[model samples]
Target: MLREVTAIRYVTPLREGGSLPGVVEADDLGTYVVKFRGAGQGPKALVAEVISGELARRLGLPVPDMAVVQLDPVVARAEPDEEVQELIKASAGANLGMDFLPGALGYDPVAHPVEAGLASRVLAFDAFVENVDRSWRNPNLLIWHNALWLIDHGATLYFHHNWPRAEAVVHRPYKWDDHVLKPYATALATEGPALAARLTPSLIREAVDLVPDEWLDDGGKDAYISHLTARAAEPEAWLP
Candidate 1:
């Protein structure tokens, strides 16, 4: 397990992250892509990344290891971009880290280069489950050591925005066009009791608990917990 340590030296900000992600090196010699929480995107975004990434790994997806990291002023040399400096400063205390995938260029789904057909299937599962973050522009796919690696799964399940009365099942299960995963799409949609069983209440609870308190008020937390509990109970709606 990675230790919960505070303070990492910021190396450089990732140009693609819309002026928010600061790449850094932890004292342990691990490179990290750190994100701040002050963007009003909230801590739930970070929680989503950790939970989804971990769960996908359990389901046999190749996700790089991830952890929350703290940024120290002594190490980071950040000049204000003037546009979003306040948000950055406010989030100074709540920085997050994604274990960096060095020497990897962003994946272009158009090229369909991911050799692992399984990755496409897994990503299809992600899409069917309504993971809103994995788009072609910021596919969050990485290529490391000649193997496809996935990262940054924070934006997902956007329906939570409306706070509709939590309903688990939508009539049609994901059709899962295999073409979306290969030379066309590599992953095929698969359904099984085992994968369904994996999305448990305890796991959801734990994943929700990982979010920082500052991001959610007591009421928000209670509502999220309630909704997640209900959602987990009807696992077929999500995993199928």
Candidate 2:
């Protein structure tokens, strides 16, 4: 199933993606927004998405179908002319792709709000486990048909560096927690346990393998793979 995506056609540039997620039409007619790593952040950003997004899916969080796409030269240069081609080629390293959510709107943690009760608890569960991609500016939480979907989990397990930092640090996960998601607390709490239980080592490994080869360089490859493998082996323990 993973190998099928042999090409990626650049559709439009998504400026809000920070690293610039190009809307891509896959060979299977499925469309996705591909996010490439910018100058400062390394390819590990893409790796983070593979590891954490899959973990969230196992935890029963609403995550979209994700995969590693190979950007063919024809598709890569699919832009208007040669000038655009150079730009695409320049972003060769971390040119990771994501499944684009149609008619999706970004959720506002403040104007939109999340609950500290159940929704908050689930997000907290995400945090406790080191899934740090859920942000305030671009929550990356998509609203489709009144249902919330999560995308772009490129910043998770950050505490892997600060493993021995502290014991159970606490601050409200998000500022809007009390207003928006409070009502959904029961719903979040109900699904939280089942989600956490499903995160098996095999699942984690499968997710890690989904990352595109180009994203991982020589020195980074082994460390990236090892990091995820270790995280999968012990889900109950703190990241890193």
Candidate 3:
């Protein structure tokens, strides 16, 4: 289970993508970029974030530490923005929080050249998860302490949004032409297969298990495990 922290203060709104994630101070004295469940994407996005982020961590990828934030609607009282206050009130219970990277900079492919092997691994991982958000125009990456860190995985595993069509698209081919790291992922032919081999059913299940029970209210744990395991089993179909 993830460490649980209660949100103690509502910091500034990030105002990034549509979800409107915000910086928040928690009881643990840590600042987190919390993704509110009341956001447009709803709890399923949080579920994807937890599962995919944890899976990346387990696969030896760099990711910010995650915690389940216990939020109280009262924290919204100080917020100046009515929109933000409403969001906080709606997401009063559990939300997903990623430890804030203090001095991290958004990844720029030219400014921050990534090594071929790491890029390959990242590409392969994204392909496996069907993450369509890591395009060149909007690479959801950060350069922290001279290393690459993956973030904002809520866009992955989109098949869950339509369960009936999941099987048909589980092994769908990944179009890598526009992937931000594609140019640097020269070792994908080798690293891709190697990474796929590591995505065992047990590992997938372990990642899925990390998601909060409330997020899995749809009872989709088994479905996630099965879909990921099946996709992992046939890397050739999805590896870019």
Candidate 4:
């Protein structure tokens, strides 16, 4: 289970993507970028966030710490935006919270060149998870303390959205031409296999186990575990 915290205040809305996740202060005295369950993408987005982010962390990739934030809705009373207030009101229970990386800057491939090994690992991991959001136009990455950190994984594991065809897409090839880090992921041939070898069934389950029960109302836990385990078992078909 993830660390649980109650939202003490809604600091500000981060209007980056469609979900409109906000910066919030929690009872734990830590700031987080909270992804509301009521967002346009719904709870599945939060599910993806937890599974993908935690999996990336287990793979020795940099990802912000996550928590199950308990939202009261009343915390957003002072917000001037009606949309934000409604979002909070609708997501009055468990939501996803990521440790806010203060002072982090958006990643610019040219400005911050990544090493080939780390880049390869990230690309391979993204491919394995079928994350399509790390494009150059919208690199959902950050540079904090001069290190690359992955974020906004709500777009991953998209096969879950259509359960009937999940098996068909599980081994779908990853198109990396526009991947933000593709240029630097030169060692993918070697690094990709090395990373795939680490994604044992146990490790994948450990990542899926982090998701909260409420989010799995569809009883999709076993499905996620099986899907990822199957995908990991055949990295050659998907690795870019």
Candidate 5:
């Protein structure tokens, strides 16, 4: 399970995407970028964040430490914006938090060029989960201490949003034309398959197991397990 922490202060909003996740100080004396469960996409987005981010961590990728942040409505008093206050009240429970990188900068491809090995693995991982957010215009990536770190995976595993037709699109081809890292995935054909082969069912399950129960929409955990297990088993169909 991911570490659990209590948010003590509402620092400020990150304002990256529509969700408006914010920076918060936790009882652990650590700061984190908290993804509110009450945001527009609902708990499912948090679920994707935990499951996918954890998977990246397990794959020896550079990702921040994650925690389940328990929020209390009392903190809303510190927020003046009516909109932000509402968001705090709504997310008065468990929200996903990622350790904040103090000096990290938004990824600029020109500034931090990726090697073919790292690029191919990330591209393969994103393709496996059908993530459409890692584009050149909005690369969900960061550069901290001169190393690339993956972030904002809340857009992955979209099939969970539409269960009935999820199977139909399991083998869907990824639209890589706009993927920011596609240009560096020089060894995708070989690197992609090598990475896919390592995603055994047990490995995937380890990541999914971190999600809390209430965050799951009735039988959601089982659905995720089934879909991802199947997807991992058939990499030839989805790995770009």
Candidate 6:
């Protein structure tokens, strides 16, 4: 389970992407980027974030610490923006909060070159999760303290958005042509298998277990575990 914290203050919205996740101060005196359950994509997006982010962290990838943020109505009542206030009202309870990186910059291929082995691992992980958002135009990565960090995994595990089609695409090949790291992932043959091997059944289950219960609707938790476990088992089909 993720460390739990209560939102002590609602800072301004980050407004980086469509989900409209905002920066918040929590009871632990830590700043966080909180993704609300009331966001357009709802809790499914939050679930994906937790599972993928935690899995990446477990695999020795750089990711911020995550916590379950308890949202109180008092914060909603103080919001000047009606839209933001409504969003808060809708997501009155538990939400996803990630430790804020104060001065992190968006990843740029030119300024921050990724190593071949690391790029291959990131590419392989994205393929395993069927993440379609890691394109050059909208790379969801950050550079913090000269280290590459994975972020915004709400766009990964897209299969859960349509359960019936998930099974159909279980063995689908990942299209790496548009992947931002594809050019740098020259060691896929060696690095891909090594990274994929780390995702044993227990590791996959551990990642899935991080998702909160309320976020899992219609046995979505089991579906996620099954889908990812299956993908992990057959890396040859998806590894680029």
**Maximum-lDDT candidate:** 4
Candidate 4 ranges with C-alpha deviation above 4 Å: none
With candidate 2 superimposed using the best TM-score fit, by how many Å does residue 157's alpha carbon deviate from the native? Answer: 2.8
Over 4 Å off in model 1, which ranges?
1-3, 72-80, 110-117, 164-194, 219-226, 232-240
Q: Over all chains combined, what TM-score does candidate 2 have?
A: 0.68
For each candidate in turn, the TM-score is 0.75, 0.68, 0.98, 0.98, 0.97, 0.97
The TM-score between candidate 3 and the true structure equals: 0.98
lDDT of 3 by residue, 121-200 (tens): 99999999988989978999999998999999999989888988988998799887899999899999899999999999
* Pairs in clash, predicted candidate 5: none
Clashing pairs in model 4, backbone N/Cα/C closer than 3 A? none
Question: How many pairs of residues collide in each model?
Answer: 8, 7, 0, 0, 0, 0
Against the reference, the lDDT scores of all candidates come to: 0.59, 0.58, 0.92, 0.93, 0.89, 0.89
Better of 5 and 6 by lDDT: 5
What's the lDDT for residue 26 in model 4? 98
- The TM-score that candidate 1 achieves is 0.75
Q: What 10-residue stretch in candidate 3 is worst by lDDT?
A: 211-220
Instruction: For candidate 5, give the lDDT of residue 85.
Output: 89
Writing each residue's lDDT as its tens digit, candidate 6 over 127-240 gives 888788899889999999889988889988888888989888889998878888888989999999999899998998998998889888896678888888888888899998
lDDT of 1 by residue, 1-99 (tens): 323446556566677875377777776788877767765677666656665666676666788776666654545446555434454566656556777
The deviation in Å at residue 236 for candidate 2 is 8.4
Candidate 2 lDDT, tens digit per residue, 1-240?
244364457777776766656777877888877755542455666667766776667666777877556665567654765544655675653355566778988876555554434374456446434555554544567888777787766666553333343222222133333323434455544454445455565665666566666665554444544554554344335311
**Candidate 3, residue 230: CA error in Å?**
0.8
